[model samples]
Target chain A: MYRYDEFDQAFVAERVTQFRDQVARRLAGELNEEQFKPLRLQNGVYLQLHAYMLRVAIPYGTLSAHQMRKLAHIARTYDKGYGHFTTRQNIQFNWPRLDDVPAILEELAEVEMHAIQTSGNCIRNVTADHFAGVAADEAADPRPYAEILRQWSSLHPEFLFLPRKFKIAVTGAAHDRAAIQFHDIGYEVKRNEAGELGFAVYIGGGQGRTPMVAKKIRDFLPEEDLLAYSEAILRVYNLHGRRDNKYKARIKILVFETGADVLKEEIEAEFTKIRASALRLPADEIRRIEAYFAPPAYAIALPGEAALAAARQADPGFDRWVASNVTGHRAAGHSIVTISLKPIGAPPGDATADQMDAVADIAARYSHDEIRVSHEQNLVLPHVATADLRSVFDALVTAGLATANAGLITDIIACPGLDYCALATARSIPVAQRISERFAETARQADIGDVKIKISGCINACGHHHAGHIGILGLEKKGEEVYQITLGGSGDETASIGDIVGRGFASDDIVDAVETIVDTYLERREGADESFLAAYRRLGATPFKKALYGAA
Target chain B: MANETARLWKDGGFRPNPWQDWPEDGALEPLDPGTDALVPLERFVADPDVFLARKGRLGVRVAAGEDVAVLAEHLENIALIALEFPSFADGRNYSAARLLRERLGYDGEIRAVGDVLSDQIALMRRCGIDAFLVTHGPTRAALQGGRIPEVRHYYQPVSGPEIEIPAGSRPWARQPAA
Candidate 1:
């Protein structure tokens, strides 16, 4: 996590005072609703469907134990005792009073966390792979670059009033756990033939009404040019992006209308003009930033157990958690652990105040004080000792954060939807809850095998349905909520937008429709090793479509 | 530099209103335009004595009779700088005020003028303005809409002069962002 210096600290504190005065002015009716709207948004406060929702940026999904504790404190004092982690890896506290929000922001500034750019038409929170530093296959930790971007974009005068909100994601490894393909700008860190590090840049990928996979504009962009190139892309979009229709304002729509080839040419020409200017990342400076994100040092030795047979024999529960929750790490004797916030039948990403404290304690205890919010809306203990896995698992279990179902069906990704979001035409969390309840049995989930189901309430796809192995998109037709299922979408190394499965399902029938598809996969899978995505790829949506509609 | 402890300027900036400084009717005689000589911003570097002597003193209060931009352009030569902010968030004056202080490096009074409100006094101070000409009263609004709450802020830098980022890794830009 990037620590705030005096400048960063004082800026936020001053902003708090500024916001407090703005609120006073608004209350006095000196500032009208129109005048107050943008200020509130820049501060990350929104008047949602139910109450004012404050979305706090967990910059690039990273949080210190202190920051997490502060969030937990806010959750307990001001908001409902729970906070919802978003797909972009930020957290939202629903039901916050507008008047109390400035005070909450003041406390947040004390811990070097604020809600700037969490909403409105501006550069948003940057995202990256949850297991960046700890991933065994990582080329480099992506968060340093992400932090740099966060600083550069925060309240940038040139970009504050963009045509639409922009999202950027970076992946440190070959696997795209960050859902890089679904963001407007995606950076894949990979080594070139000469072993120099660089990025494979993708542009215009988004998951709104027009969900499109970003086209690769630059095959290899050196790491230093990240900001300048990103600026160029944004500059082009800021100037030329359509403002006529709100739905048509995203860069994805522009890319679609202008054609990828033409867009690429324009971006390249812009890049050339700006590449050598102050924006290019000089090697020494990049190395300076890179130093901040260097992997935490571990005991210079491999894990005693190359095999997990001993752990399995010692404790069955720990064994199960290790099998499911433990992931590969780049450092020896270290393993990445995912503490599933999505406990069976609970909200997909809701972590209570106490649960937050407990997760922070465990992260500081087993790993460094470092924790990451996953795009799956879960929390990651990035560098836990393999030996301390048992202790970490026990602590997690007590917090109700332990769920040995990382890629299982019950670990569904869902947005707040109509339950909270004003833009949602339908509900997603309820659908997710229904499915989780349907498959509450651990044995049933284990049998399903690496199944991923993502649901979005509306076209925004905040739940990332477009990338789900079993994607469910909610829609409204004739004032009735309907769901359209898509098959074969995956948010991994091999990413693709799912194909729409046939006709839509009524709101009441959506749960059953999803169940029918899952049951179909279970019955028809060729072998035990074939994962849901592979099985769906082989069988196609036709069979699942037929399974649900009874005719295809 | 807002939140000046002396608390002299009630408005957000250093624009000390003549009404506040003296009597309510403390008015100055309006001056007519001299000639076609545009005030050069570099007078502080050119013969400072000559520029100062030539420009003389500017009026504490600006009227429709005087050109604010011309005085603003020669802020370096002028002993006093008073900028009128019609209303907070009507940030048009923020640019003009910032130019007077930052671009011309004016060290004298940089006050907020016209339609001044006291509530924005701290904010005006932060933007590097020195004083304000305000409508005395509670900086409260027309209606008691409600209280606005506070949370903590994460970042430190706002668009200003003091904490210039000295931004690293310049990008290739054919045009400075419009």
Candidate 2:
């Protein structure tokens, strides 16, 4: 929703030209593969197993219908007619040729989008709550700040070659939909007792080979010091973070090794020096950015409850969908609808070009012209009038986007693993597919209630397996693919890393292993009111471990 | 001795390199008077006053892993500080350069040396490196051709005062002087 000003336009156009030249140099052999890798990565191009993958940043997961349609066009024209929305709320085209990538970037630039900082060892695309401005519980919209950070981190001169990749996530609500605690830097926009706005800053939380929950470095940082504080943190990390071991190079490891107290002191010292510098965001600039994300106009009154209830009662299918896919909005008489990308058996986040176009058309007509991509690998219609729910549902059903599995067991989050990823050690999509098929029965899913099954092909944790209630990590052990399961991990406000429960499961047996864990939760839950995560916390891993690994 | 592709780029174009690198292992004694020798930071810090009081102009070359804090105290006397890249991908010096310019307010020449490439030239300049000792062939050619690829508009301000911050625009948006 943030429009590109003249400065923004010039910046992206220049970047496109720069990247195009770099690509030409690479193709001409003026730059070797090793030399060109980081450059290409910074532009969000990765040479995958079969071909190049182009990841386009959907800043803060916000998209205009026009932008969404452009994405659909890129998918149709360049890539295999579909795009995989990643866990970070960005979209990846698995089969874009190197030659076509600059063109794709050109197209993105025209739509106020570019893939800058989507990858490589730099501050990555800033993510926020998918239900940013629309959520009923949010204190403030996090997207404006996300946009500000996006601008600051783009082609940042000092931080471009960090020891390891960094990710920052922000949330403005008490319930952490953006999973802020599992990021290198996490911010929760909050109002103090005196009603002054600021942030609760969390540092160093990430899930890779070594999963870590971020430490709260500051209880309150004033909104004006946002960029300054972030600069301080990054400066400290850049100067002191480990470069010897790539695996231990994330800011989390720095926090872990230096101890949070010491790291906090160092960061605070740096903050004290630069706090009054130019990086301190002026109040006017903050307000200027905030204005762009102000809420859309809604009708003064809309009679929707009766109509929605009638439609639900008339069609059980519609009722099920409304129950699962729809959520309450901050504005009265409006609802936030999640268009599920996770179908019964297909890849978790892949959406066809047609589905994308349909979503764009639907958003343009029913909701405001805005669309959102949730980190759970689903698309969101953030401001649909409640009266239009039935029409939205019907359109979604026709487009095959009306899957009533928003938070159900079948709503899995998985990465494009060994199938397309060069970093993957095992196949993750197949495991997710098998589990989705096992839990395909809507009745069974309803009985199970809110459960998240996440799978990653390798320890890199691209699948976010460490944050799932039922986490499965696929590993190559002795030339055989095995899945290691973890229990009780969560990415919400109550964030914790899942624990590995005994030995790994063979690919053929992973689905049954997942089913066993689900069955154990169902049997042991206090009541239907207790979700899988709550039940796991109460019961601990002993019961789930026992169920999976037997009495031993 | 410098790499074969190393060219002295300062101000806006390549010029003869006046400063010669003083090897870390080489003895500090017996250097010619007024010889512009860039010694390693470790050697310079071993005896800061010795280098500061030397007849020749003082320049210190800092490795990517070395601390730049030591140079803060002697900034007024130092003529040049060469920050090493080790490789183009190692960016520790960028932070070091910013610290020198913004934190320590060092106005002396800040040069980027070692593995310098065409793509990184613009970034080095923004981080307050006023000069470059480029060792990549294509980078030298690009510099010679005045074809350094760059996005002149910046969203964040670095230390230098020459950068223009247009009024009424977003405070963060900056453009380098034409």
Candidate 3:
């Protein structure tokens, strides 16, 4: 919830003007498509399957009610009456005309938001744990450092045109909700033995055609050296990362080719040269940024526990939701509420304009005017008082935003696959819809227990299928759409890429295949208490493969 | 291709290019004795001793992915280091230019050649390339119009005359233009 100062305001305003000029140039044929592509991409405009998609950055997944309203307004006016929240914690409007994009950018700037660095081969929008400041297990709030990085990476001259697009994620909590391990660079904010704040730096992690869990290059890097160290890492990658083959261009490949130890030595040498340079974060500046995210004053001695329990008992639907969607908060009498976008039989993460407006209102009323978008494609009301849970649930239910499947089998994370993306090989949304419909029974889902089903349209893994407990990748084999399954992947504190099961299933049989795998887990689990991931880890992929492919 | 009519922009205005490219047709060829001629890095590296011993001003054109360290010790002898962009999106030259200035401390003229556009002007300047050999028609027009679209308030401290000092307590924020 950082507010924009004069300097920040000026920067965004000028960027709008610059983008306006670029658009005019492209329209007038003063620049060709080849020249205008990167320029447009930097501003987050993408030519999708049907129309130009505009992705707006939600920095660190934090938003104010006012900003959320503006996004709702954009969806209503410029695009279709809904927006798709992506796995990277950003939102994409899939139908904005090229001529309307500049105006859209101007509107975004009014709310201290812009599409800058949301795309293109640059330091992209920085993400952090959605529950950064309010999480109970947090060692430090990462928003301050994330914001510092956000400012530093925006239009950074030397890093704008890297060998490939770069993503950086930060996590302050012991639980990695940000999926930091799958990013180009991941930082875990923690306190050292002496009680000083620093980071355990992880580098060269990403998922595309290749999936990699990041390597911890530095055990502890002082918080003051954040930007300096980042610069060193980027400088090394920009100069040496592969460019001849686009597939091998990510820094992860560089880390693989050069070996992590040698690459670490090179990065360390560069860090030594610039550690005390102008990029070092001054303590006062860090404190100044931190003040913006300081916890709001909590109401003392609120009577919510008894009322919350009574409300839950009164309504089984609300009780189920409370059990699944609610999480503990650091402050007393408060809870973090996850408003599931993955409603039964719906396109996951697509929030209608009305739903957005309703969520904005709910956030203003119950969550101190703040909302967060999680990387799992869900919205979070981070500071909902336990007393207000029933009322919040009622409001969300009215807006069709209340889904009692937060971490359950039906809470799927899927991408806008062949239906929207130009790069997609097959359909992903339809498959997710089918699976959701197949498991629509709440009781059945509860019986099945926690299972993550992530679907991607192509090998790009935008849906993060690699991290799914049951990963589904949609591909075109022999000009026929086939869904491949991978099991045992998790994106949490213990991150691992899933392994592919035997052969893929056709579109017609894919839903049944997923059901078989779920049923297999239900039979194989130690008990209902044993989660799908835990069971998969304990049992490995053998039983699931047999369930899907038979014991051949 | 290297355009002979392409304008050279230095210190904020367009000027005539003093140095002519060797193999005027822009081919990879053996270097011949000449003054004020810009040759490819490969030709110069083929025989640096011979090129340094010649009686002429030397300029080396570096490809996008060429190793910049090859020019480190000879930076003093070179008058201009032209970093190629092959494509505007190929940004390896930006790193190469920064290494030339910040790492090697090569204060001599650094020129951004090939695929140079107005949109990239501000970034190239920030990376310590003070000279631009612009060929794209619209970019040349933009440069001549003195309307290079740019964001004056920068977030990173880069070496260039275009930026002032870091404003107030935020060392990351470069002050806006007066």
Candidate 4:
């Protein structure tokens, strides 16, 4: 909910003009594709398989209703009337002409948004917990710190071109909704014994061909030293990270190759020299940034428990939605409502223009004119009143945005695999669609309980299949699409990479194969109270492997 | 032996490059008076006393992987440090240039030597590389014409003076006056 000041405004506006010139130069044949590639990528334009996909950054996954409307407008005018929200909490327009990019950027700038650093080997969009300020268990709102990082990393002079793309995620809550462990650098907001705020810094975490849970480089980095410390980490990685092999270019590999202790020593040495510099954030600046993220004004009203129960009694559909979608808020009578974008048989995160507009309208009317995009490919109304939940749900129904499957089995996270991606070896969207259709019944999904089915078309793991409770990785085997299943992965506070179960199944049998695994879990669960993840933890992968591959 | 238009942009303007590239493979020799020879760091480290005895201005060339820390003690004596970008995609030199300016406070010409393209000119300049040894014809023309598209406002405080937000002006909310 941070508004861009004049400096930030001018910074984005000038970048748009600069990119406009670059686009013009490329169009006029003054610059070839090889030269123009990095320029276009830094501005979030990608040459995909079918068309050029333009990804727009939604910083810290927060947006105003006006901004959402502008996104809808852009989707309607420039793209194919739809936008896919990516796992990084950003949105992608799959179809946009090269000439229209500048125009699109201009429009985005008007709404305090741009596609800068959405792609390319640079510091990418800094993500944080979607429920930053609103979550009950939050230690602090990580948005201000994330924004500070966004400012520091945007077109950072030395880090413009890194060994590979760098990702940073911050989580302020006890629960890691931002998937901090899977990022290049993860910051967890913490308070020291003396009650002074700082960060628990984790470095080298990433998931691609190689998956790694970030290693804790610093137990507690004082909040004042955030930028300086980050600069040190980047400086170390920039100078030493492998450039010869693109696959081994991430900071994770560097930490693996050089060992964390040596990397820490180098970073500490760099930090010691630069910590006292101007990059040390002034106390006033921290306070100034924090002021922007102050909680929205709420009326001191009675809790909506009675009314919510009454409404749930009246409509079973609304009851199901409330059960799955609604989350507790710090303020009374207010609730965090997740608008599930993962509808049955649709692309995991695709929202049509009408759906976007409707959500925008609902956010303005029911919520406090604010919207949040979750890393799990869902939109969040962070401050919806529990009293207005039914109204919000009704509007969502009108736009077909209400799926009522927030953490349910059908709430899948998938990548834009062979459908639109040039890196994909197999199709991912169709696989997600098949699974969703098979478990379309609300009762069945509710019965199965919280099981995340993440799919990626290749080893890139853009779909975050490594963190799914039921991860499905699609690989091309001798020109055939084969689906490999992994069990018991999670992206929460206790993050772990899932283990692959035996041999992969053919694409035709993958859905049935997944069903057998789910059925096995249902039969073997310690009652319905235990979720799939909990059950898997208790029973381990042996049973699941046996269910999938027929008893070894 | 480069042409006149093939000049280095130093201290905010174009100036003729005085130093010639060190021979790729040859015997090391003493430099001519008043001339600068850009020698590789490895070659310089092999015999530091020999390079030190030269009468001409001294410049050290660093490859992408070489440590910039080795030049800390020699900062005052070195007139220029030319960092190589084997390809435009390899950005290790950017960090090296920044370390020279900010960390070591080396107040000499830090030139970006090889594979320097037009798009990267502004970023390299921001990282405190004051000079460029550009070989691309159009890139050189663009540098001479001052046609490099650049954004004046920056969010981060790097090697340059940051746009100061006046005290008590709510730095986060204060809009720039038109």
Best model per TM-score: 2
Q: Which structure is stronger by DockQ: 1 or 2?
A: 2
DockQ: which is higher, 2 or 3? 3
Per-chain TM-score of chain B, candidate 4? 0.81
Model 3, chain B: what is the TM-score? 0.87
Which residue pairs show backbone clashes in model 3?
none
What TM-score, computed on C-alpha atoms, does each candidate reach? 0.78, 0.98, 0.97, 0.96
lDDT of 3 by residue, B1-178 (tens): 2355448888778777878676744567845565687878998888898778867689999998898889888999999999998878788999888888887999889998888778899889988999988767778888989979899888998776464777657998896457
Per-residue C-alpha lDDT of model 3 across residues A94-140, encoded as one tens digit per residue: 99999999999999999999999899999999999999999999999
Query: Model 1 reaches what TM-score against the true structure?
Result: 0.78
Q: What number of backbone clashes does candidate 3 have, counting pairs of residues 3 or more apart or in separate chains? A: 0
- Per-residue lDDT tens digits for candidate 4, residues B1-178, read 4575346766556777778766666547744555778889998888787777778888999999899888888889899899988888889989888878877999887888877778788788778887887766668778877888877666555663222342233322222223
In the order shown, the candidates' DockQ scores are 0.08, 0.74, 0.77, 0.58
True contacts kept of 2: 0.74
Pick the winner on DockQ between candidates 3 and 4: 3
On residues A213-311, what C-alpha lDDT tens digit does candidate 4 reach at each position? 889989899999999899999999999999889999999999999999999999999899989877788788899889998988887895778989999
Q: Model 3 chain A: which ten-residue window has the lowest total lDDT? A: A542-551
Candidate 1 vs candidate 3: the TM-score winner is 3
| iRMSD (1 decimal) for each model | 8.4, 1.3, 0.9, 2.8
Q: Write candidate 1's Cα lDDT for B1-178 as tens digits.
A: 2332232343322322222221222347322233112222332334444434542353343331233445545554455555554434343354445435544566666655555444344345444666544443333222122222322222222223333344223221111112
